[model samples]
Target chain A: MADREWSTVDVEDIAALTAVYGGNPARWPADRRAAAVRALAMDGAAHELVVNEARLDALLSMVAEPEISAARVDSVVAGALARLDAVTAPAAAKAAPHKLDTFLPSPFDLVRTALSWLSVRAPQAGWLAGATVAGILVGVMTMPSATLSGAETTTAQAGTAVETAQADVTDMPSLLFTSYTVETHAR
Target chain B: MDESVQPQPRVGTASASAAAPYAGNPAGTLMGLGPEPGDDALLARIAQGDRQAFALLAARHAPKAMKLAQRVLGNAADADEVVQEAMLRVWTGAKNWIPDGRARFSTWLHRVVVNLCVDRRRRPAFAGLDGIPEPPDPTPSAVNVMARQQTAKLVSQALAELPERQRLAVTLCYYEERSAADAAQILSLSVSAVESLLARARRALRARLSGVVQDTGEV
Candidate 1:
């Protein structure tokens, strides 16, 4: 609130402000207080109006407000906390997300678990035994695709086959003939 | 309007500190030494479910909140119920508080209290008008006490008879001693609108209290 803000304030405005705020210039809006005080100092009508309002202020002053009790503040806090606890207990029991996380592992948890197992130091004899078995399996499993079961080519062989197929496609003039030719080649 | 209650000037000159704008204890809870945690920081903690911070905030503010609710509802029990609900929102609804726009936490609390008071007003009062406690008048020794009580009852009754917004404006400005700007902020009205409400309320109160004022011997 500033003095300039009250530049538009007029006599009527002062009277209204006085009727609402009483005779105390201190209680008036800050921006308009100086102007109001100046207005009242200069104007007899508004000053009388404020003096009349102050009498009502004196009359309204007799009402005894309820006394503040330390016990009541305690009671409100106790009552609120109790109610909050009661409500929260049932709510937390139903579908607590934090609790749910304990039962249902997250993707990060799965990844962490996998990494932990991978980082574990296996026995040297166990590693040697595993390598021997894998080498034997690889040696016995190295056979032509036709001899093996359906679609059981090694990864590199499958990739090469895909490249050869794509090469044929590149050489084809149109997709209609290409599909037919590929089907024929498959047969 | 409480003459005995000389409320310290909260609204200062334009150059006064604007950091704390709320009329009700602008600096939330202060401890020894440097500035204590403000309402915003406390709210952040409450949002994280910190019960200690919630209790501290409640203790710091619930008295004023309780008083405002009591004045608005006119029943201690109903006032307690609504203020508690408002405090519960402070705990449960802390996440909903937006930190921008120079918003004060106490303003949020007062808004919740006022809105709750308004909602509570819509329902039929279980106690009705008869429930307003009229102090038992007796004994020559207590004439002063009786007179004050009677005057209080007359003023309160007159206040009750006023329109809802007018009564609220009177309560906030006259009783609570909140500045018009602060009252406007709580009521979500323009400053002039609140002033208009206060002015209208003052006129109604003046008309109603003509006999009472004459009896009080105020020239």
Candidate 2:
């Protein structure tokens, strides 16, 4: 092994060696190919260490090849089919519309469909602006005051007390909305 | 969760009429049970509501998927669960299966299995822990199983001794049978980074397992 040209080894060459023996031991370079192996493992004592590691790696690859039982395959298939059946049958049953399905549109879906309809049936720009103003005015007109009238004061206090009693439900966000685009240039 | 609503396959002998007509095709055994009729065929059948075809597809791919999961998780039970979850995702994604496009069914399944395993590995349950106590030697557990298993266990043990990235590099290469390029893709590491990991892992295994076998060659 003396006079062996280990000088030819480089880090990229070492990388190539690892690539060859790294996953596939079948193609591992010969044991006497120490110079190449040394280069692969960064030379020095690492050369020998890598050789031994490769041998151990070969052993471990043998162990990883599990002997799967045919019976296990059958059990797995049956179990899968059972699981599939469990999931799919309910879905098939649910294909028929329920009472809630008939009456309650999915909120997001309803919003999407309404948006599409509005896009199709959008009014003239002037009408749209007038409608937006009118709707805003109506919303402001219908707004309930926290400050109550003389007779409404007692009722308002009682309502406030009842709402405070149910604290968990009080802070929930309301889902109601109507959208209107603001036209800066037109305004 | 509704047990009663689940499809109940009639147990016992099948009626000639009830058996799916496509079940016994000569090509069935030749395909060695891949997801039914390959991606294109399965996608077509699924579009037509052929649940049996979908079942065949799932049954076909489940084993290899489970094996991949097993390799990643290093536990058979967890592997089984991962396969179940992965197959469920496949079934649910059937409508979106693109038969003629860039999506290869095997690649999709592999991605699903890998993602699920990775997710589970990140969970508190499987995050870094001391090596599981080696099982009772098979009278010869680590040594006699075949050089590959011994190499794998040594490598795995050594890898377990490593920082996470190095261990992942080693496991993906040795246990999962991945090429360095493929491992780099899976781990999102550069090819050079992957090489460094493998080198580190090999050095660790060598240091840990050297001289473990004594004269007369006993472990």
Candidate 3:
């Protein structure tokens, strides 16, 4: 039906259409568009009403769009970033830069390093690992009681075993736990 | 397109231009010209105070944000100031953002610009349409051309006379080429509310401008 000119609109309809859509047929409601065009062409009063609307459309069209300048984009971004620096500067001061290679190795890197170390010192690593297991088992299973009144000789041997175990196992625990415990306790 | 006719920061021509896709760029929705989808990462970078990330986000949205803001405030410098503050908020306030998918970055961006415009608009002295001057000169081409340039102030003043919501609705739906749904999202109103505001606004502006834009009989 919109393909043909339809005389469905009177001047009032023209008034209503123009009020909402202005004079631009391109902007008119699609269903009533052909009717509005026909009214404008055939009726003088309808033409008058639409022309008034069309005039406003033309006037409104005279207002220009703001230019989207690249310079504005750069300025806005720079402004925001600067403000962000101002905001976060205090907290950012606590951490050393992430670029510092000497600060710490990742866990995977640490493990790889240990593996390489052990390969170069295989005899020492074997001795250390075996001694660590032995010390742990001995500590759990038997203790040198500060006093074993009836068994002085056995107590003496137990004391020797405990001393040996404690000496051998200190390396692993201190390496793993000292830094962690120090920081935890410091906090 | 007319070099002879320089327009101020007005709503109507923006709408006319917006009635077509912006600059004939098929991909140009308000957001289309900005960063593509997945601003969550961008916001995360912003949250971490990554300046480059913030810059990336700003480049995508600032131009459109500026246009919307200037239209609302009716001044380019004021709009620039508002968008500056808005972008600053995006920077400083990004840490608080949850980056939830519930709202697009543009939605928040629009809200920020509109809210700033509303705040700035509160201080200005706006008048009603009671004393607008007569329409454009009815003479031929030369007078029309001069009228187009001269009437710019009256046109802006006439637009400023409408209720803020009416003005915003017209700008959003017409000049920005935002759909009712999109306008609704930006303004946080129902789609029907946006449609009604637009309808009322068109009529009010028609009466206000007083046909300063002459008819060429194309309608």
Using alpha carbons, what is the TM-score of model 3? 0.52
TM-score of each: 0.65, 0.52, 0.52
Residue-level lDDT of model 3, residues B62-116, one tens digit each, is 7778989978876666777788889888776676777556666777888889988
**TM-score of the second chain, cand. 3:** 0.69
> In model 1, what lDDT does residue B163 have?
96
Model 3 interface CAPRI class? incorrect
Of candidate 1 chain B, the 10-residue stretch with the lowest lDDT total is B10-19
- Candidate 2, lDDT over the whole model: 0.53
- The digit string of per-residue lDDT tens for model 1 on B111-212 reads 899999999999976975537575587789898888777887888889889999998888888788788777889999987888789878888888888888
Against the reference, the lDDT scores of all candidates come to 0.67, 0.53, 0.63
Worst 10 residues of 2 chain B by lDDT: B10-19
Question: Which window of ten consecutive residues has the lowest lDDT sum in model 2 chain A?
Answer: A175-184
Top lDDT: which candidate number? 1
Clashing residue pairs found in predicted model 1: none
Candidate closer to the true structure by lDDT (higher is better), 1 or 3: 1
State the displacement of the C-alpha of residue B139, model 2, in Å, after optimal TM-score superposition.
7.8
Looking only at chain A, give the TM-score of model 2 against the true structure.
0.29
Best by DockQ: 1
Tell how far residue B197 is off in model 3, in angstroms: 1.3
